[model samples]
Target chain A: MINIEDYAERQMRRRGMEITYARMLPVVVRRIADNNGQVLVNSMEFDAYNQYWYLVNAYELPVGTRITSDTHVTLLETHTNDTMEEFSGKIKIELPASFTGNVCQALFYQVLVK
Target chain B: MTGSTRVIHHPIQLIVRQPLTPVNIYTVLPGHIRRVVGVKVVHSVGVHLMSADTYLPAIGYLSLEFNNRSYHMGHVDVSFDNRAEASDAYLDTEIDIIPGSLLSGHYENKVFTGTDYQRADGTITDKWSNYIVTIYLKALSDD
Candidate 1:
């Protein structure tokens, strides 16, 4: 298994730093669409003091919903899709059209580098 | 290097039969791999079918969990367009696996409906096809 703490330690070590502590943070977003239209979830921003955030994984609940970053780029592109939903910078999710009211959810996993 | 470690490939095959539901599969790692270095997926060609003048790949999400860890690896597309047939399609990873660890793979197949193919006499309905997918794990091992 890939240890999140070990992965964060290596990420910091590559930049000539030592990780004092590491943690995994879960960001969950949910939205309900009133009609048969697409729901657009805005980009989520992460800000913390003395800690760096790295996107390690992401998931769409109910699955098969399109998740994107930077307006157009699909978060999981090509074969890398099987390994990790690795993305840098920003994150957003566009839920598919649904009849009646439906609830859509997106989950992102990030590692805190401190 | 210390124990005659070398690279190996472990392949797991899955058959998707239903739509709109998540199919779960798992495998126990051989008693050798110390670190999994890469991952690649091979999608069966039949997954991408031409229906009602539309060539659509069956959209699906793939999630991976190793050793029952709290953190998951994904919810990524495993459609036909994302197969690892090309040279650059291999996914590099740094997952360390204990010998005999359990690795699970989950897939959710989505339904895609296309327009009906209209002809002079009758119209043909579009249908989704069931297919197979193989996931390859490249790892460093000491046998």
Candidate 2:
């Protein structure tokens, strides 16, 4: 019976890869309010890398006004940028009416996987 | 890090005036800058309301455009607010640009006007002529 560490090392060696951790990338998404005091929904596409991306953490911006109660982050498996069958995802964040007429930034982290 | 490529930070300031009117500012990247890696809003004035009742900046929108593409489809104030102490508030991304490429910045003041601004001490005045916003671009140069 092979030990867990040895099995992991063997798998890494077989895959021609190094023992590393997930790569976390920071992304900022903005939700703008329209003239009618409605918060517009915003989305960002992650097509920069050919790896599976997962949301790690998210927080609303503007320092003191960290109101993220109404903010929703959705991860979609569909490819919005291209039809290529690569590992890509879309992140969409919706803000509530309270965020109307204000430009809010949400800082989020995405982890990349191979 | 290569010997041929050097890092540089280019700063640009925009003077915002006239409510509901967009203020457009542009800068040509120097010959050394090959790509813009990051952007940060360093400082800003005349954006926040002086009235004690209001604590947030005036309702405004800011956007960056380069190479015929906009970095953020909408406003970027949250990720690039001027209240940042250091370079902590920055958008880390790679934007390819050539020498002499035109990088544009657009801003629009949505709420406040010249006459209706109230100071913190409950004084109304039109002394605020313009809002000054400074942004720094971190780039890589292939010298």
User: What is each predicted model's overall lDDT from 0 to 1?
Assistant: 0.54, 0.48
- CA displacement after TM-score superposition, residue A87 of candidate 2 (Å): 32
* Highest-DockQ candidate: 1
Give candidate 1 regions above 4 Å deviation. A1-114, B49-58, B82-88, B111-126
Worst 10 residues of 1 chain B by lDDT: B113-122
Best by TM-score: 1
DockQ category of candidate 2:
incorrect
lDDT of 1: 0.54
lDDT of 1 by residue, B1-143 (tens): 45688888888888865443346666787878888889876665446563243323545657776653323465456655533443435588888775687786567655443333222222333454666777888989888
The TM-score of candidate 1's chain A against the true chain A comes to 0.50
DockQ values, each candidate: 0.05, 0.02
The fnat of each candidate, in order, is 0.00, 0.00
